[model samples]
Target: MVKKLISVGSILIPTVLTILIVNFLFDIVPLNIQGLPLVLPFVICPIGAVLGLIGYKMNRDNLARAGMIFNIVLFLFPIAFNIIGTLSGGV
Candidate 1:
């Protein structure tokens, strides 16, 4: 149960950080001096991915898979958003 909780946390934290980073990047959210959101996802998502992979190897399949998916989406979203914005003249 504890491992499952960690897996869920691994998913949620990075996902939320991704949203915050994107919002900050696009100026949708006001910036503060503490810019952890700017740098945290790069650290957190990779760590989460590693943890998820370890969990998968240990057979905690569902939660681990969810974590991996969330980590992947967190990494990809900003790049995809930027590309779409550029193409659509929204950037």
Candidate 2:
């Protein structure tokens, strides 16, 4: 049960971060939080990914796998975006 919760949290944290980032980018709300984009990808996502990996190793199941996948994607997302942006002259 605890392991499953960790997996679920790993998946959820990134999803929420993505939503917050998108909202901030589009100016959908008055998000005055500073350094959120950098913090989410660098600090939060890596932690989530590590937790997910541990959960997956402990459980060896599909939910854990999904959590691992989500965390990895989220963690890599900013780096990938930066590379593409530089290549496309957006950076």
Question: What C-alpha lDDT values do all the predictions have?
Answer: 0.75, 0.79
Best by lDDT: 2
State every prediction's TM-score relative to the real structure: 0.66, 0.80
Model 2, 1-91: lDDT tens digits are 8988888887888888888878766878876885577467777887887878888888887776787778778788778877887999964
| Model 1 steric clash pairs | none
What are the RMSD figures for all models against the true structure? 3.5, 2.0
lDDT of candidate 1 over 1-91, digit per residue (tens): 7677667776777778867877677878677835666556667788888878777777767988888888877867656766888999965
Give the clash total for candidate 1: 0
After superposition, candidate 2 runs with Cα above 4 Å error: 89-91
Cα displacement (Å) at residue 27, model 2: 2.0
Instruction: Evaluate model 1: give its TM-score.
Output: 0.66
On the 0 to 100 scale, the lDDT of residue 75 in model 2 is 80
